[model samples]
Target: MSSRLKRGIRRLCSTLSIPLLGCAPAERWEIPHFEPWVPEEFHPASIVPETKTVIVIGMPVSLPAVETSPSIWYHEEYRTVNTLLDINAYRIAAFLNAKGYPSVALPRDGYGHISVLIERPVAFFSHRHAAFLAGLGTFGVNNVLLTPRFGPRVRFTSVFTAAEIPPDPVLEDPLCIRCMRCARICPVHALPGNDYPDGLTDKRACASRSEELLRHYVSPCGFCIKVCPVGDDRKLYDRETMEIYDERKKEFNRLHRAWRHVRNYGGGERAPGMINKTPPG
Candidate 1:
């Protein structure tokens, strides 16, 4: 809140066209500090040399909050985010293909399948670290990815290819602190102990509780996302606080335009909605 810091934030906001209200000092939050994990002299076969390009697209998945049931939000947000991912995946695929890289799309079929399907586990890898490395956003204390645009309110999917694409650089900033707000809010006690030195979390515990919640037919609990100081703000200007907004907006627009184009183009692949249906193989 000092004049110098205020000026620095103002400069950032102005350069990015982000509004200043509801904005907090970057230092106020303990942003995730990720160590780079790239291996030297990586074998090309690990990534399947046939892929010409790889593009990882991050999408938002909603969880139920106290204000709005996580289940309802999850269903709604899942569809919206899934659509956004599909559209963006197509756009990136098209762009890369046009550039002469025979690209293919990857779906959310678990990490193993993702590695095999994309043939570039390193490029298409999943995890909080990979997400951070991709510049989608930083991590919260709960280890959930939080973007300035959506807070911890989003889920992501990636695209992998054989194309020699440049990976997106990680965003550098300390946005998350060791504050246990998110961990404290978890209804399932899935978070790690506050004093754990590694700052690592137990995913199995969290996922198990999430699954249990899903089985009960209640709204999915997004206590982690909800309690995170980052995503709690609902202000428009606050949407610009994170780096993912630009990509999210571009993906949204691309999908909207592409949907219209598909509707008009006619007689190509099945209409958007109909194309994804499973047929008995």
Candidate 2:
């Protein structure tokens, strides 16, 4: 390893509190305190010909605004979180490259189409799955990553490089409580009320609801997430704490109506529908 790279790893180990490493000239580029997961086909070699590992990062959605005002802040807040992650992903990739290891950061949620046809809305990769493999979180009933610290309230992106970094262990324990709260609470009945992978079976219904909301520019319904009773942030948005903006449908609509229709972030061009609707008086 170059002296410059060794110095960087030493600092990283110190900051991350990893054990004494490379004391007597160990293999170079083993990142400190980091064992990020490289899924079956995502090994660095597969992704970038010689990438030795993947570095995953997660940013969590805070309480209140994002969770309470799904109609108002849903997409807007999502944009904010993604923008932040995108910048960091790029920065990390650049950092790796500067250290002589070629690396590439994947685009945040808004970009990178797994399906070029637009009709099929899937990401080029599964950020949730990546985070889980990196030991950052696990899947929930809503098929969202339920993190130990953030529940399903996080957004993640990753970078791949040839740094020879070890991989983080996969979480053996499940995170979902099997409460089925997410399904029982979905306004659109999009969830099948089952556990991970199979729970979000009604993709068409979910997409249709989003398309409808796009006409008025209102944030698409994310009621399932808003009502999820997990994480410390949950209390910050749930009914018991927020008298006005909690996820209860009646009050939520009352609030949404007051805002009339919000703006869209993803789906293209408004198609028309709620033409004469007015904000609550």
Candidate 3:
């Protein structure tokens, strides 16, 4: 792609538009790193034979909102980010198509429902993997891609285009601190605490938890990302202290109280004490 065309694509994914974004060469799939883990059918070229580049766009889930995991507030934010990622990918693909390149947008989440994941955890495409190859981020211990700006709190979608846009370099430095917070905080013990590719998530257990949460309109159960200390977002939001997530810390009760308030309504009921303790009357 011409430098001008690349600039135009960047403009489309700018903060004023689609937020975090990057590009990867379709051939990255055959690299030794991915060749062993990702199957051939999952490659961009496999899905779109004409694909020469893959554009990955991301939208972040707010830290404060995600802090209220399994709550309607975070649920809505997750949905909003996923929606924005998909919409922006579609627009970017359309832009490429208009430029005389055949392009196709991939869905943010390919599964029809959380139930499907319980049985078949893999998706038609993996945006997190695409994001990594695109130099958007590196893989975290959580098995999620961690962008410097948003950690694992961002949702991503991809656009495949026949145009050979120059690909961004993959990040060499690893992002995961390996604090083990994600594995420890997993309510279902889905995370095995091993570094990614080695300690993949227990998809069935995680999906089962998600399925239960979805019944309550709070499907994602974002405990892992919520507790993650990565991302400039923590600094931006003045939530640098991880202790704020510890409910026993009386000093952060006010924040906890606010989260509890959001969980109180607009979602299916949970069992007694299933969420935050009743706020002071």
Candidate 4:
């Protein structure tokens, strides 16, 4: 944002005592830090060699777009963010290297050590873990991370480096409302009743259901994310009916029916027939 626009925003915010919308940044400058975000005893040369700090970057999910058709728009948001993250990660690594510190941007999602990952039903590395350590947010019952401003409606990536940066304090207060809405709404009975960080969900069952949903082009099945009555969207959406889609029933149906074409190639790869359809409200 331009200086004038930023000043204008700050002035408007000053009138209302809003905490300045922590959900997304306002294109401001940030200070660098180097605290023990990662415990050295747990670190190994193989996982993140010469890493002194981990920088966790979180991007918020678009609100109404995600709420409109999370299965579809959230997938689109994920793909876009992942691509942007990849590009930025490389740039950050190079910048760190130039400053005489080796830095690596970890892949956000992938099957690392296929056998082990499959056997364990978990990724080798997790952005959620890094985010937790960085004080970015807390975890949800479904193993998804929730930020104070966005709840679980966010995606994160991390960069490990030899550079020492001060670490932010992990959030001490619990963010989960323990409403159990996420569990009751799961169509596949994958998520057992649980809360953030302390309880575990059936990962295998969750993955299986997500895979099944993939055929219908709703791989995300963001029931947990959508249902969480937190963040700004909660005021805009009704947890009872508009959790999965918008209040407009016909538009929601159109979006759901068109997913087979919009997500024809995993995600964000719209097929030719999908061009005529309007985006869900």
Per-structure clash totals for the candidates: 18, 8, 0, 6
Off by over 4 Å in 1: 1-47, 50-54, 61-67, 109-124, 165-167, 193-197, 231-233, 237-281
- Assess each prediction's global lDDT (C-alpha) against the native: 0.45, 0.56, 0.82, 0.57
Candidate 2 per-residue lDDT over residues 29-112, each given as its tens digit? 233322243233433344456655556777766654444333446667766777877887787678778877887888866333
Best-to-worst TM-score order: 3, 2, 4, 1
Model 1 scores what on Cα lDDT? 0.45
State every prediction's TM-score relative to the real structure.
Answer: 0.55, 0.68, 0.94, 0.67
> Taking the tens digit of each residue's C-alpha lDDT, what string does model 4 give over 1-281?
23443343344334433231211121101122212322333232347657766666666665644553435666667678667666655656666677677878777775643234335775545667667767777777766777777788777776676665544666777787777777887666777776644467777766665554454454555667766766664554433344344565643443245543444454434323332232332
Q: Which residue window of length 10 is worst by lDDT in model 1?
A: 20-29
lDDT per residue for candidate 3 within 7-90, as digits (tens), equals 998886774466787889999998986887789999999998999998888888998788877788888888888887778788
**Which regions in candidate 3 have their CA more than 4 angstroms from the true location?**
245-252, 268-270, 277-281
Task: After superposing candidate 4 on the true structure, give the runs of residues whose Cα lies further than 4 Å from its correct spot.
Answer: 1-46, 69-71, 112-120, 233-281
Model 2: CA > 4 A from native: 1-45, 110-118, 235-281
Say which candidate scores most in lDDT: 3
Model 4: lowest-lDDT 10 consecutive positions: 20-29
RMSD of each: 15.1, 7.9, 2.7, 9.3
Give model 1's clash tally: 18
For model 2, name the residue pairs that clash.
35-167, 35-168, 36-168, 44-51, 52-162, 217-262, 217-263, 218-262
By TM-score, how accurate is candidate 3? 0.94
